[model samples]
Target: MEMSLQSMQLQLQFFMHKADDLHSCLVNGQGHVERDALAAAVVSFLYTCQPYFNHLESTVRSTRPQHTSLALNIYTQLLDIYQQLCDKLEQLVLSCASYNLLCLEETEPNSVSHFCVGQCQLGQLKLTTFLYCKPTPYLSQVDTRLYKRMRWNVEKLQVGQKTDKDQGGESKEREAKTEYYFLCYEDIPNTHAETDWGRPGFSDGNVVRMWSIGQWVQVDPDPITETIDDWILCDVPQANYNKLLFLGIEEPSCCIATDYMQQLLLLWKSADSW
Candidate 1:
């Protein structure tokens, strides 16, 4: 029996959830250095694994016999790597010595910093990120950028068939209601994209994905900026019912958005009623 892509993705999701649990465990642990290292490793593993699985799934879905062997090879490699990561995570969890989190350093009482707004390509999504900065290790150095903040668009999607009649005619037409979203991630140097994500043996400067976010935003241009302002920050009709949520910059968030879109798409496709 051939395994379905959905089944394969389910297994991958399980592995990802395990990785998430490991990250949470590390977050509560005392070993700052070790915890951060292991957390980073787990995130790195996830970032590397997804694009390969996506490629394999696409190939399998294409039903090209010539690519079956190649897809299977990739699937096997993914499973092997997954096992290795699971082992490493388990070992780290077992060896962790729990301790209360401590404040490593104290800051000046009157220090204050304002949020800096910036825009960048975040995993194919052109979104703004708010930065919280703090002084660098050197007293005379500029502040380091910390905690990239982004909005996760979530909307209560609706799908339904509409009834309409031709003028003075009994004819009827039926159409399927489906929406599509595309995201493009531009490659930047000195980033993890070198070996972490993207095609297996290809180096494309841009990665495009078919994705949709919750509650689409109608971004009208501001009178002065000409440049489209932050859509999430704007007050729109959906703002009351489907406000965008925020997440701090983290490696896991990369896959999390894709996974969310997958689930939402599945729901939209599978729903029979509004």
Candidate 2:
């Protein structure tokens, strides 16, 4: 049996209350640690509320009631709630991905694009998309400190293999944990690596410097070629370290939160519609 408008409105109202609670909680102390949980909750709310919007819109259309204005009022509130959830999701995702706080989402095209541009290192753009998601983090620009350890093992392993029978009852067993390094560029806030606002603003000097350094090859190297590089890196920085340590070296990659990626996708989709 089909439900009445009052029943559906009640359900939506209940969710609206929960959304308010979530908003308050996030505004209270949301961070990288609990961002994924918050995002998941938002998504759950959106999943439940979306069909209601569709149902209401359909009801308005099929019924063709004279009180369309009242229906529009409810519809507007539903859409606004959806948009707010999207914003919150984006915020959580960005924090998780940038800081490696462990938020989750999906692997959609738009997500891939946002994560690729934001998560992947600047010099590794030339690498294939398949290669970009590797656990190694940065592919092209690895720190020499890692190479030093790898080299030490390469030579030491040879030495150990050759002279194993040194003691009377025991062989020399060398055990070492393997590790890797990644490079991330951080943009100093007021520096040239910053993106300017639409009409009047300065551009990213760091990407320009990378372009000048023969690392980044822009598709369109026009007079504003530097601007193009900066544009691509609007979400990236010129120098930042990882969230943890690996054998005394900082961890090697920047990872965008899945929730944030979804938020950007939603925003991109919304803009596409406009």
Candidate 3:
């Protein structure tokens, strides 16, 4: 146990230094930085560090009883460094256009590149296509059938809107408010697929259900008051009833939120575990 703790401490210190270096790079490379390369690097960093973060969290929890003070100190340090890295990544992602971060050569390039749509997990780093749907009273489980139907309907409506705008000219401008936002995974196999905007593989019938956010989720800035900030997925659904899907993005509007950062901080504080 002593050796394990010592190893964890070394790992944590290494990560802290890495985080500091990354933060400094982002701060220094403001105007002339290569946005795409930086975005890819940030994503790769998150993917690599996630497993270590998970292992450290589990270790801290399991060994707290035996090495209470030391374990807590390490965990606190971990949180501080992790949060700093996440904040830097988020800022970098939000500053550039979505297309700038596109990994075109990758087999499954992310729809929005560095914008993460779901919770982070060990060994999983793929960003998925997602739809912004009107909120229902209850959270509905989306199956393949429903998913296809919804996609078809949304696409048809969008086409119709385009036709109307083309013919009606300025007259249709009043009705041009977008009711939905759709980001699809690029370059799936299919000749008939709409590769320009939507996800691929619709013709093959091997549809991967996309993530959906309710319109009520406040993903965009409030048009009326303009005060509400955008929210990103912070935690996925967990076994505990109290630990439902969390939606929050950190401050400064550029920093990306980590999967467990906000939720874990809340849990640790509430339980007095840190």
lDDT of 1: 0.36
C-alpha local distance difference test of each model:
0.36, 0.35, 0.37
Off by over 4 Å in 2: 1-3, 66-274
RMSD to truth, every model: 20.7, 21.2, 23.9
> What TM-score goes with each of the models?
0.26, 0.27, 0.32
Clash numbers, per candidate: 4, 13, 5
- lDDT per residue for candidate 1 within 1-274, as digits (tens), equals 1455455557667666766666576666565687656645644554454554444433332332345786666555444443443344333333332322211121433221212122222222322221112221211122211122123222232334444455544544444333222221212333334444553433455333212233333324343453445455544322111222222222333234434444444464477322
Looking at candidate 3, what is the lDDT of residue 109?
Answer: 38
Q: Could you tell me which residue pairs clash in candidate 3?
A: 90-254, 90-255, 90-256, 91-254, 91-255
**Candidate 2 clash total?**
13
Top candidate (TM-score): 3
The true-structure Cα RMSD of candidate 3 reads: 23.9
Instruction: Give the Å shift of residue 128 in candidate 2.
Output: 35
